[model samples]
Target: MTDAQEPRRARELGIVVGSLPTGPHNALTDVPGVRVGHTTVADPPRLHTGVTAIVPDALGPGRRSLPCGLFVGNGFGKLVGATQLAELGAIETPVLLTATLSAFRAADALVTHVLAGPGHEATRTLNPVVGETNDGLLSDVRARPVTEAHVFAALDGATGGPVAEGCVGAGTGTTALGFKGGIGTASRLVEGWTVGVLVQSNFSGTLTVRGVPIPADDAAPVPEGNSCMIVLATDAPLDARQLGRVARRAVFAMARVGSDFAGGSGDYALAFGVPGGAGDTPPPDDAALDPVFRATMDAVEEALLNSLFTATTTVGHRGTAVAVPHERVLRRLREAGAIPR
Candidate 1:
């Protein structure tokens, strides 16, 4: 495929987000022990949805729940198990993402997966975290095409390293910022610690790239979309409380990418930290969080951009959602001096 005909990440086009150096994969899996997998369900003119799973290291033998935090940028989502995560400040199972109507099933599958894993034979109580974005505009939401098997496939196939992005998994039928949106990921190394972010971009607003706005005609008719889901992982040896604060920064980064956080947008960010990370000796002071916060924001912004850049056009039940016109966007950025001509 030609350049315009193919999909690529923001970094591939020289649209780096911040000054921090990225990990080897420049993705959420760069945090180590974090794996991602997707199960795309594309059945032509009617179905275009799937499942994305984020599995932390605490899911196998000697499995131990990890410290986690949930930050809600907007309260318009049907996020299952949020109350428990908020009250308990941790996650017992792998986090899953899927279409709006399929969130419940995905959560159920997650619970089943955890209960069936080694060491959880007799466990009764479990909280399965699942987040979703409405894909009704592009798919038959009422049909609920995503099934337990699909969720299981995602969970079972997850692996660490580079993750697939855009027009896949839960983002298959999603749109954002007036363009086709999907899965995106990015990571940053802060003082030898890794902070990684993965986003399901479906929320809308003005389409901006490095502070330059694409002309409205090519940026869709209006800033219209419903939700976005952000998943952040880090190996900083932080607890749930600190992760919550860092997660707030991740949500704030949505604004940097032009998210309006509209009334209908269900914007949520879930952050988790591995136990035996660098700084396990003595937790760093809150005063030293400035760099971590900055890194989180920057990674989120780039992840959102990657969601748009790597997505290709799609035609579904509702209508056609075109991918961002990368060449045109780059032209705008160049003229505005965001990139060299």
Candidate 2:
């Protein structure tokens, strides 16, 4: 598997996904205490998959659980530890993303890492929230090259700032909207609170960016059995129910980019927040949440575009998903007046 060649994000091409201004890094890591890490596996003949770790809030020592929620757009896919997450409405471990078949192993490895962290001596139960998308179209799903070490490596290597996207980590061999799909992330500041999103895009649908339709390419092959995993983070002090509301909006963003939400596709979104604790400012009421919702929809949509734009052509055993040509998309957006000349 050749490395993603000449990756570039949408904004680099003068294309903005929405009207809202982006956070400093325009990434999920823009959320306070959020960190991301990736390990791309490209071991020839087979194995073009890896792990991506997102620690919502630095979890170690005596850190408290972060409020979290889950919204299922489709239930035809595998997501480890969904029930417990929905039941508890909080998470104490880092969120992990990996290929479909590798999810359980990744979850186990995550549990191990959390158990071994600085503050878990007598902790009996630990829930590892893991998400996945089918990448077998490009990689040998049977091999399951991802190991516990890879999980730990991703967890231990987490860092803040700009996140590495496109054909990297769990997105190594994913396909989306008739193009090579991979890890993508973006963030937006709404009213003062920041909402950030990261996506592992491997679903099927027509591609559209900023109201401009991206014509299908004959050279690219469509993938079978769809799925997409979205992770959203914010510093807003939101509870599980509120997070679920925003999570649904993220699916709208996905639809805006062209996902059909087919029966076979398991579309899942997990949202978490680390609100200012104690005497810190309280989160806004529901009446004041409209701006946050809008920002979420915008960030998610832009993040999907960023996924396509930053990824390069991927050639695999099953088929090849040529990267979407940025010049062509830029032209369409220019024609549609989505991008100013």
Candidate 3:
């Protein structure tokens, strides 16, 4: 199942990580009303985990909080609503990525789907925002079969458009650098505003792209609690400290693609802003945030190289992960010319 075959993204393999001009369906739902969903859970003797959902609506409905931010590039993750999303920077619900021991059953199915919505019935104290990484080298991380009806079918099948990368949902049995990573997306359109990115990519190192290291496999192995879970969205009016400085440049665009930040590797990154505080308008002053931090570090390095070019070698259970061989990265992007020989 070579990712069912349409999986060749990363700019169709020419590997163009940034020139800033995307957003039609470059994903992260191209920003407006943003949506995404997934429920993948490969069953077998070990059941690879799953669950993912991100909604982020602007004003018009319930569960509306928005304007969020968090960027612990390496605090090592568990991430269940990072201190009330950094003490009320905002964000109500619908932001669950999963499988670090099922993240409290996906934050108790996102506080029971935002207290079963519809005016929140006089709600009191809410903070569900979950995120995690450890796919346990390939599932069976002590059999935490992510359930809560797979977090209510990834929040009743969250939607908007174009999202589904790699092993799917919480990047089922993730892995990275060594290969078989999962879930990846990208988008950018700056001035008109619409930077988007989504990555789960389990994390390790030596997978570089624009600077070209790409030869992974260094004797294999590479995967532990190794984490990374960036999820960014933008409609622009930013303010949670400019979306935490655009979530610290999306983890400094993941150090261009080859992580060295491995002290177990938590490395988060969450930036949000559908409409942003006190406002009809107000977040863009600081020399206008340097082209929104260079279109969010070029959409977080092409969404972690489209999560290793749409992953597909996953075997999971004890381990397998071997999917970054798109014709050996298209012959090292055509002899380093970066594509098109």
Candidate 4:
């Protein structure tokens, strides 16, 4: 899309999220060897769901898995392969995200893709990580329209660099904080390590930015059970234990964007670290990890804003979800001195 036609990110609108500086793309792809792709099915009033794939290119060669961690803030939804990933603290397949009912199909497709990789002929077992959020508000979710082809397309088409956000992929049919919600990503550089976060937002609460609540005059009553899925990638050489700590920060960062963490919000976060090209670098001292944890929270907070800021109004099977009014938000931020006038 052209510059005028392209959706704008939060930073572009003068809503700077944190003190940290973002990477070149301000996206998950900033981490070396990490790629993101989306397959959106926008059939309008009937269907608006699709699949998103996050491929950690470092998983090939002599390495078959990356140190990974998962955190579940609420467990009200289905997440395929979560138990295995948490138990092993490693991920062998590219992570996939899709609508609620289609999670199983996406997981199956992810397994097929991994097994098809070179040197997997003898592999008898594999765990495919897949996450989901309810998108029935904007799609015919019961139809489970996501097919293997869609999942494969996202995986094979994954690439590095800029990522598409808002109303795409698994976020196509999602809503958040009284506004349209979709895929969003942000990256931070801390202690020479790149920390990137990607989020699929679909929860509800008062919208807040930089401690300022942006009232939603058009706020509509949304369903009770919704969720947000987060994925964090870094080249920090952190072990699964450390990554788990970082993942916890990501889940808590949701509150910065005003998530209620309600009884039915299936808030989840998965963090994985890819080793350096030379080899696995020794993790920094635990005391030095404070910066990494702070950066993770900052990146997660910005990512959640991006999901709301870039999303456009969407009319789906259930009803209409209006996009957050940028001007109104800016005015509120200015009044609160959160951003320069």
Candidate 5:
């Protein structure tokens, strides 16, 4: 379907929120050259797991990569290849997100995928950007079932449109705040630019949406073990350092929604800018970014909101179900006069 048709479809499917309109695709892929793919493992009564690949830019051969940055809010999580990205301020390959225990296998598979693809000269050293969240609840983490084939499938299936969320991809077996949480996404427009956020929604604590708490009486209690990995992407020109700052801003956004980065919660953010004119040039020095910085913060804040807004409730193994009742939530917000009738 066309991009415009996608958002209409999302709304029809009861998968949307907030006042801001979405970009062409309403997904991270809406950010120019960004592309997304997923590989979901749905096996019978249980075993909910999957992988997601985010392809930054698909420019023809030898073009410079995107300027990127990483932020570890708590560092209790496992993030592969972050050191190199932080040191070099560039991500030469697609970013992969998956279950925590599948990290090693995913990283290995990513290396193989990159090496086997076009433009590999055998002399190139690969850094596969793989991030994860614990998904032991629904799948057998010890099995290490995810392989190079699954990684490749996700990468090859990547598309640029409204992405599937909630019990899909890396969010298959995730939980948040003692409830059922999976994946969610949202975007914002700042100074004619767009910033988008995609989150693997495995986190803890009472979920608050735009300052309004999802009251315990109104929703399920927070889960005991939870964590989250947030991926932020934008088309704006931001250097690795600036992107790092943007990444931290996500924490504020998370806090605004009531996440205290509680113990046992692996809250992390990875931010990157899409390569545009002149390809991979460093962003303007900090002093010169005063205007851009303001815009970046706004974008980051809104993106976090989008992540929560687009998520829906899901059911997992052993008949465990979590539901984010949109109608009930809207009713609560209306009672508080948070939205117009």
Candidate 6:
């Protein structure tokens, strides 16, 4: 189906949440030129996992590349290829997300994928951005199920539209705040510009949605150790440092909704600004960077909200099921006067 048809399908499946209107596809890919794809591994009793790819756009001499930044909230997790991206302030290849134990494999596969692409020149080095969250709860992580093919599949199927959330892609085996949480995304428009956020939800602790705290009431709460990987994309023009600042702002949004960045939680945020063909770099001086900062924070905050609002409850592994009751949540919001009558 065409990208235009994805949102219609999402709405038909009741995959969308919240009252706010979404961008064309209600996803990070909704940003012009952004593309996404996934490889789901559903070998029951063995592996339940996958990989996701986010291709920003073609990179070349005349093409304007996305300006990106990274922020490490607690810094306990591995984010491959960040060092170079942070230092050079550019990313030439697509970004990939996958299961925790598969970071190395994913990175290697990404390198191969980039090399195989057209116009990719001979280079002794390649920076492949790969992020992850633990998914052992529902998958055999040690088995190393995410192969190069999975990574390639994600890259090959990239498209701009409403992306699959919950039990799909990298979120296939993820959990959050003791609930079944996986992939979630949200976006917002500021001054006619769009900003989107996507997350791999596996962090531990109580989760709050729109100020509604969801404590773990089940016999087995998610362990104290877990992590979350967040990606923010926007049409706003921002430099690397500015992007990092924006990524930091996402932490506040997470905290606003009750994530404490516990000892084991690998809370990190990556932000990228969509570049306008030419002469789009921000001014060199610090003072001139204020506008970019504001835009980043706004995008980060809204993107996080989108992540929570887009996710739904899921069931997995040994009959374990957790669901976020949409009606109940909306009713509670109305009763508390959080939403207009």
lDDT of residue 100 for candidate 6: 85
Cα TM-score per model: 0.96, 0.95, 0.38, 0.96, 0.84, 0.84
For 183-204, candidate 5 gives per-residue lDDT tens digits of 6665665545677777776666
lDDT of 2 by residue, 213-325 (tens): 79677665776558889999987777778888888888878889988888899899988887562114565678987888999998888888888888877777577778888
Clash statistics: count for each candidate: 0, 0, 0, 0, 7, 1
Q: List all candidate RMSDs to the true structure.
A: 2.0, 1.9, 14.5, 2.3, 4.7, 5.0
Candidate 4 colliding pairs, count: 0
How would you encode candidate 1's per-residue C-alpha lDDT over 29-64 as one tens digit per residue? 998789999999998778888999999975566755
Model 6, 164-218: lDDT tens digits are 7766788877766666666766665554566677778777666565566656565
Best-to-worst ranking by TM-score: 4, 1, 2, 5, 6, 3
lDDT of 5 at 280: 49
**Ten contiguous residues with the weakest lDDT in model 6:** 1-10
Per-residue alpha-carbon lDDT of candidate 4 for residues 257-292, written as tens digits (9 for 90 to 100): 988888888999999998772236877667888999
The segments of candidate 2 whose C-alpha lies over 4 angstroms from its true place after superposition are 1-5, 277-282
Sequence-dependent TM-score of model 4: 0.96
Go through the candidates in order and give each one's C-alpha lDDT.
0.87, 0.85, 0.81, 0.89, 0.67, 0.68
lDDT minimum window of 10 residues, candidate 5: 1-10
Winner on TM-score (2 vs 6): 2
Residue 88, candidate 4: C-alpha displacement in angstroms? 1.1
Please give the lDDT score for candidate 4: 0.89
Query: In model 5, what are the clashing residue pairs, if there are any?
Result: 177-222, 177-223, 178-222, 178-223, 185-306, 186-306, 202-227
| Regions of model 5 farther than 4 Å from truth | 1-21, 217-225, 277-315
Candidate 4's C-alpha runs over 4 A off are: 1-6, 277-279
